[model samples]
Target chain A: MAARGKVYLIGAGPGAQDLITLRGARLLAQADVVLHDALVTDEMLELCPRAEKILVGKRCGQLSTAQQFINKQMIDNALKFPLVVRLKGGDPMLFGRADEELRALEEAGIEVEVVPGITTALAAAAASKQPLTKRGVARSVAFFTSSTAPEHAEHDAIPDTDTLVQYMGGREAIATAERLLAQGRHADTPVVVIENCSRPDQHIRRLTIASLAQGLGAAHGPVLVMLGDAMKTRAHQHNDEAQLPSAVQQLSA
Target chain B: MAARGKVYLIGAGPGAQDLITLRGARLLAQADVVLHDALVTDEMLELCPRAEKILVGKRCGQLSTAQQFINKQMIDNALKFPLVVRLKGGDPMLFGRADEELRALEEAGIEVEVVPGITTALAAAAASKQPLTKRGVARSVAFFTSSTAPEHAEHDAIPDTDTLVQYMGGREAIATAERLLAQGRHADTPVVVIENCSRPDQHIRRLTIASLAQGLGAAHGPVLVMLGDAMKTRAHQHNDEAQLPSAVQQLSA
Candidate 1:
C-alpha cells in the first residue's frame, strides 16, 4: 500500500511574504502540490517552486470552482502525492473556509496539519497601530461577515461586543452598517475600513458606523471593518495634538 | 542628536519557535532589547541572543508589571538602544495589549513597526485540526477574552458568533460558559478547549458550551476555547472511514 498523502492547510498571513510563519514556509517548501486562494501573494508561490501550483481562488462576482470541487481535487492529488499545501490568505482556520476542506480530507482518510498565519483582523489593526483590545477603550472583539446570507440576517441576531471586525464586507458595507445599527450597536460607533490590507496599495478609512456607507464609496477593493469604542480612542488621541510627538504626527498624517 | 530608537511590536505566534513569521524572526535577531511575555517559549528566545532579554510577563494570578510601567520601560530602553523588540505571544494587536505600548512609543516621537504573528486563536484551532469557519457551518468568527476584571463583569457580555475563540478563559471556564448561555447561544454548541497550545504538552478537549465549565475542572495553564456550529461539523465527519494513505498518516501523525 502506498503512503497516503498529507495536507497542510497553511495561512499565508495578510500580504507580505515575510509575514508567513517559518513553519508555514517550511511546509510550503516540502509540498508536492500547492492550492492557493485569491488573496495569496505571488511571493508566497515562490516559496513552493517545486510544488505543482493550482489557483483555486474565489473572487466576488467571478465564476470560480466550487469549494467542494476544490476540496475533492486536493484529496485526489494528496492520494498521489505525499504532501499537499492548501495555502490561504490570513489564517486558514479563521474565515478561510478551511473546515470544508479539512472535512473532505479527513473523510478521505488523509492526515492534515494546519499551520496558522496572521489573520487580516490583526494585520489591519496592527498596520493602523490600533490595539483591538484596549483596557479602558475596548474590552471585547466581535467578528462577523458582511457577506452573510439574507435568510440568516432575517432569522439570526447580531452579537454585541466592544469591537467588531467584519470580513468580506467591501461590497455590502452599507447593508452591514445598517444591520449593525439595527442590532442596537451605537450609531456613532467608530468604524475603520481597511482594504487590501498588508498590500502596498492597502487603504484605510476612519468613519462612524452611521456614515460607513458613505465612507465605502471612497474605498476600493476588499475590506475588513473594525468598529468599537477603540475607534473613539483614535479621535481623542488625534485631538490631543499638544501631547503628540512630531514623529507621531508625521506617521498619522 | 543621536538617532532615536525604534520599537518593533512582534507577535511570536504559538509555542513552536518555527511558527514565528519570517519578519518576526528577523526582527528578533536584530533587537537590542527584547521584552517578552510569559507565554513566549524558550526556543523563541534563541533568535535574539545579542539583546537584553527582559521577562515582563503577566500570569493570570501572578504579580505582573502594569501596562503603563511596561510602556515606560520600553520608552526608556529605546532611548538607550536603536532597536527594541516588544515581543508578544501571538499577534500584538490581538489580546497582546500592543496599543498601549504603540501609543507610548508614538507619543515619545519614536518609530514603531508592527509585525503581526499567528495568534493563539487560529493556532489552537489549527492544532486541533478543526476549522474555525466552514461553508454552511460558520460564516463569521469571533475572538474574545473570558478573562475579565471582577468589577467589569456587570457590563461585560459575551457576544454570539458562528464561532468563538476565548483566550485566557481557563480560570473562568464556568463563568464564561454561563455568560455565553445567557447570551442565547445554544447549550449544545460544540466547544474545543486547547491548553498550552502548540507546546509539547498540548491538550485538547471537545465538549458542548453548556458542559464546558464543568467539563474543564481545575485545568491549569493557558487555555483557548473555540465554540460554534462549525465545531459540530467535526463530530459529523468523525464517523467517516475515509483514511489517508497509511504512510502519509504515519509521517504526519
Candidate 2:
C-alpha cells in the first residue's frame, strides 16, 4: 500500500512563479500529485516537472470545479500517492473554502500541513504602491469579496475601516462604494482599481469615492478595488516612475 | 560612482527562513547591504553571503531601531551600494510602515521595488488550523494592533467584522476583547491567541470572547490574537496533530 499518504495544502501566491516561497516550491518539486486552482500559472506548473498536475478550477460560482468534487479528488489522490499537494490561488486559509476539504481529509485519517502564501490584497498593494496600513494615516486593514451567494448578500457588505481591499470586486464597485458612503465614509476617500495584479499586464486606475460611485469602464482581468483616505498620493511622482494613463496626481499619503 | 542602489523591501515571512519568497531570497543573495528588523532570524542573514547584515531591531515599544534612523541608513546605503534590502518581518505593504521609507527614498531619487511576503496573521491562521474568512460564516477579515500611542487611541477600537487578527497584542488581549464586546461582538465568539507563529516553539490558547476579556498570563514571543464567530469549534481536535499544550484540537478550517 502507498505509505498512508499525507496532504500538503499550499498557497500559490498572487501569480508569478518566483513569488512562491522556497518551501512551497520545494513541496511542489517533491509532490507525487498536484491539484491546483485555475489561478496557478503555467510557469508555476513548470516547477513541478515530475508531478501529475490536475486543474481544479475555482472561479467563484462561474464555470468552475465544484467544492465537493475537489474534496473527493484530494481524498482519492491522497490514497494513491504518498505526497499529494492541493494548491490554491492565494493562501489556503483565507476564503479558500478549506474547511470542507480539511474536515473530509482529517476524517479519512489523512494528515495535513498548511503552507500559507501571499494573498492577492498584499500583492495588489505592492504593485500599486499602496500601503495597507500606514502609521497615523491608516491603522487597520480589512479584506472582503464582492462575490457572494445570493443568500449571503447581507453579510458580504464591505466593512468600515481605515483601508478596504475587495477581491472579485469587478462590477460591484458602485454598490460597495454607495454602502460605505451611506455608513458615513468620506466622499473623497481615495480609490484604486487594480486589474490583474502582479502579472506583467497590470492596469491601475485611481479616483475618489464619489467618482467610483459614479462608475468605471470595463477592465481586462480579475479586479481588486482598494478604498481609503490613506490611498491618496501625489499625482505627479518623480519622472522615473511609470507614466500610466490613469495615474493619480495628488499628494503622497 | 557606485550604481545608485535600489531598496528591495522584502518580507522575511513569519519566523521560518524557508517561508521567505524565492524573489526575496534572490534579492538578499545579491544585496550589498541588508537592514532587517528584530523578527528576522539569523538563518535568513546567512542567505546574504557577502552582504553587510545590520539588525535594525523594531520590537514594539522596546529598545529598537527608530524609523528615522533606519530611513537615514537606507538612504545612505543606497548611495554607496548597488542593492540594499530592507528585510521586514511580514509583507512590507501591510503594517510594515513602508510608506516612510518609500517616500524618503523616492524623494531622494532612489528607486524602490517591493516584494510581498506572507504576513504573521496568515501564518497564525494556518498554524492554528483556522480560516481567516469563511463562506456563510465569515465574509470579511480585518487586521489591527493594540500598541498604539496614547494620542491615537480613538481609532484603536476594534472594527466590527467576521474575523479580527491583532498583532503586537500581548498584555492588551483583555482590553481588545472588551472593546470588541462593547462594540457588539458576541460574547460567545471563539478566540485563538497565538504566540510565535510558524516556529517550532509556538504556543496557542483557545478561549471564548468572555474568557479573553478576563485576560491572559505573560507569554514568551510576539502575540497574534484572532477572534470571531467563525472560529467556534469543538475545542478539542484529534490527537494525531501536534501535541502542543494549548493546541486547538478540532477540524481544520
Candidate 3:
C-alpha cells in the first residue's frame, strides 16, 4: 500500500533556526507536510518552504488542535504523501508528548523515525553559560514538567538535589517554585527563569528560589526554571545584572 | 590590544553528522581550529574540512592529550584565530567538562559561548521511540554519570524515584546497576542500554534492572542506561522478543 508512508518526529530545538539538527532541517525541507508547534520560530519554518505547513501548537486555554487531531492529520497526510514531518519544540523525547504521537502513527501502520534536537534545558543552560553539572557544584541533574498530572506529581517527589530544571512552567511557575520550597529545597537556592530561550527575543532572569515565586509574575511566554547550586555558581561567575532588562530589574527590586 | 578571540564550545550530538544542529554545524564550518573528542564521528568533522582539526579526546588509561594541555592549546589558538570551536560529544553542558575549559578560556581573557546539542540520553530514548517522561509513568528524570569522582560517589546517593539515565557506564554498568538496585529501585525495573547511540553503528538492548548486572558484561562502548517505569511501559507495549535481538536473550534466560 504505497510502501506505507514514513513519519519523522523531529525536534526543532530552541527558537534559533540554526539550532535544529541537520537531519531535522533536511526532513523539514523534504517533507510533503510539516506539522509544527507554537514555539517554533519563523526562521525554522523557512527551512520547509516546499512543504504544506500546519500550525498545531497549543497554548494555555487556547483553541488548540487536540493531540489526537494532529495525529490524525499526520496519518491522513502520510497516506497521500510518503513523507511527513511532525515537528516539535526542543527535543521530541523530552516532555514533547512524542510517545502519544508514536503510538498513533504505529497503530495506523505508519513507519516512524525520531531525530533528537537540543532541548530548552540545555539551550537555556548554554545561553546562561552555566554548566548543569560541575565538579564541586552539581553532581546530579533533575528534569521535571510543571504540567504533570496531579497523581504523578504527588507520587514523583522532587529529590533534594543541587540541580533542578522545570519545563513548561510559565503559568504555574509560582506554584512549582513553592512546591519545591515546601519539599525542603533551600529557599535561597539560585534560580534562573529563561523565557523564549535561545531565540533573539530570549529573556533570562536570575533570582533566588524564595524570590522566584514573586519574580515569575513578570515573565512572559513559556518559561524554563532552573534551580540549585549550579545556578548560584554560574551567577557568581557571570554578570547577572547585565543579562536582566530594566523591566525585570524593577520587578526583582 | 587586539580584540580577544572567542571560543565556542559546541556539541556535536551523538555520532550522526546530521544530528548536529545547523548552528553547531555552521560554527564547525567557520571554526579556525576545531578541537574534538574521540567519540566525534568522521562525518561531523567533514563539516569543518578547512579548519585545523585537533584530537583532544580522553580515552580510559590511554595516553592522550591531557585536559590541561587541551586547555592550553585552546588559549594558544585563541591568540591567533578569532574563532575556535571546542567540539564535544553530545551536549557540552551535560557530562561534558565545559566548565573547566570555560574557566581556562575566561582566565586567559578570551570570550566563550556554549552551543548545546542533543545529548545521548535524548538520542537513545528517541531511537527506542520511548519518551523519557510519560504521564503517570515518569514524572521526573535524572541524568547521572558513571564516570565520576569517587568522593562524590561516596558522599551523595542516587535518587530512588524518577527515570535515571547513566552516561559512560560501559565498564561500571554492572556496578551502577547494582547500586541502583541496592538503593531501593525495583529489581524488575525496566532498563534500556544503548551503545553508540544515533550512529550508524548504534546498538540497543533491553533488560530488567535485576538482569542488568549480568547483562552488562556484553555491553560495548560508551553505553547509556535508562531505568524506571517508563521503560517498563515501553517494554510492555512492544513485543519484547521481536524487538530485542538474540544477543540480549541470554540476560533474561
Candidate 4:
C-alpha cells in the first residue's frame, strides 16, 4: 500500500497570482493533485501545471461544488496521490468554511496542514493606500460577510467595531452604508470599494457613508467594502489620483 | 542625479522565511536598501543578500529607531537608491505604524507601495487549527493590542466582536482576561495563546477565559492571544495532540 498522503489547505491570497506566499507556491509546485476554488484565476493555476487540477468552485450566487463533496474528494485524492492541495481564494480561516473541511479531514485520519495567505482586507488596504487600523482613530477592525450558505441563517446586524470590511459586498453596499448611518456613524465616514483587488484591472473608489448610500455603480469581479473614519485619505494624498489607477499605469509603463 | 527611487512598504510576514509573498520576495531581491523591523528574522534577510540592510529595531521595552527617523531614512534612500524597501513585521496596514511613514514619504514627494503579508492573527489561527470565524459561532473577528505608545492614551475597554486576537499581549493577557470576564463574557470562553507563531519554536497553549485570568506562564518570544468561542478546538480533535507539536515532530521525522 502507498504511504498515507497528506493534504495542504492553502490560501491563494487576493487575486494577484504572485500575491501567494513562497511556501504555498512551493507546495503547489510539488502537489500531485490540486483542488482550487472558483475565484482562483488561471494565472495562479499556471504555477502547478504538472498536477491533476480539479475545480471545486464555490462562489456567491453561482452554482458550485458542495462542501461535503469537496471534503470527500480531498480524502480520496490524499489516498491516491502523494501530495494533495486544497487552495482557497483568501485566508482559509476567515469566511472560508475551513472548520467543516478540517473536521472531515481529521475524521478520515488524513494529516492536514494549513498554510496562511493574505486576506483581501489587507490587500484592499494596500491597493488604496489605507491602513485598516489608524492610531488614535481606528484601533479595531471586524471582517464580516453578508452572504451565507443555504444551511446558515443570514444576519442583518453589522459588526460593532471601529472599522468594517465586507466581503462579496458589492450589491449590499447601499444597505450597509444606510445601516452605518442609522448606527450614528458620521455621514462623512470614509468608505472604500475595491473591485478585483490585486488584479490587473483592479479599481478603487473612495467615498463616504452618505455617498455610498446613494449607490455603487456596477462592479465586475469580487468586490470588498471597507468603511470607517480610519479610511479617510490623508489630508495630503491629493485625492484618488495616486491610488490604484496610477499604480497600474506606472507598473504597466 | 540618481533616478527617484520608489519605496515599497512590504510586510515580512509572521517570522517564517518562506511565508513572505512572492511579490514581496521578488521586490526584496531587487531592492537597493532594506529597512526592516526588529521582529524580522535573519533568515528572511538572507533573501536580499545584495541589498544594504538597516535594522530599524522597534520591540516593546527596547530602545529602537524613532518613527520619524525611520521615515527620514526611507525618504533619503529613495532619493539615492533605485529601490527602497521599508520591511515591516506583519501586514503593514494593521498596527504597523504605516500611517506616519506613509505621510512622511508623501510629504517628501516619494512614491510608496504597500504589500500585504500574513498577519500573526491568521498564522496563529492556522497554527492552532482554530478558525477565527466559524459558522454561527463566530461571524466577526477583531485584532487589537494593549501595548500603546507612551504618547497615546490606552483603552481599557475591550473590543466588541465575536472573536478577538490580541498582538503583543503576553504581559497583559491576564488584565485583558479580567476585563473580558467583567464585560459579561462567559468564564468558559475558549482562549489560545500562541508564542513565536509560524517559527520553528512556535508554541500554542489552550485554556479558558477563567483560566487565562489566572495569568499565563512566561513566554519566550513575541506573543499573541486569541479569545472566542470560535477558537475552541473541535470535539473530535482529540485534545491538543494533533495541533502543533505533533506536526513538528512528524515533519522533522
lDDT of each: 0.76, 0.78, 0.77, 0.84
Compare the candidates by lDDT and give the number of the best one.
4
Worst 10 residues of 4 chain B by lDDT: B241-250
- Per-prediction tally of clashes: 5, 11, 1, 0
Mind giving the per-residue lDDT tens digits that candidate 4 earns over B71-190?
888999999998899999989999888888899988887878888999999888888889888877888888877647633424546777889988888888778888898889999999
Residue-by-residue lDDT tens digits, candidate 4, A1-253: 3487988889999877788998889888878999998988888898898999999856644433487789999999999887999999989999888999899988988888888989999999988889998877887788987745523423456767788898888887787787787778889988999888888778888889999998887888999999898898886763453345343444335
Candidate 3 lDDT (Cα, 0 to 1): 0.77
- CA displacement after TM-score superposition, residue B214 of candidate 4 (Å): 1.0
- Candidate 2 per-residue lDDT, tens place, B1-253, comes to 3478778788888877778887788878878999999888777788899999998856755433487788889999999988899999888988898888888888877877778899999887777778888766787889987545755654467776789988887788777777887888888889988888766677888888899988888888878889886676523344322453121222111
Worst 10 residues of 3 chain A by lDDT: A244-253
- Residue A133 of candidate 1: its Cα lDDT? 85
How well is each residue in A65-115 modelled by candidate 3, as lDDT tens digits? 487788899899888887889899888888887777888877887777777
Tell me how each candidate scores on DockQ against the true complex: 0.51, 0.48, 0.42, 0.60
lDDT of 3 by residue, B1-253 (tens): 3766778899898887777887788778778999998989898899998899998857655422477888999999998998899999999988787778887887777777788888999988877877888765666788877435665564567764478888877666677777887788888988888888866567878888888888577555678989888885432244322243221221224
User: Which segments of model 1 are wrong by more than 4 Å?
Assistant: A60-65, A154-156, A218-220, A233-253, B60-65, B233-253
Give the DockQ (C-alpha) for candidate 3.
0.42
For candidate 1, write residues A70-179 as lDDT tens digits: 88889888889989988999888877777677777777888777778888888887776677888767767877774345766656565677788888777677877777
Q: Which candidate is the best by DockQ?
A: 4
Candidates, ranked, DockQ: 4, 1, 2, 3
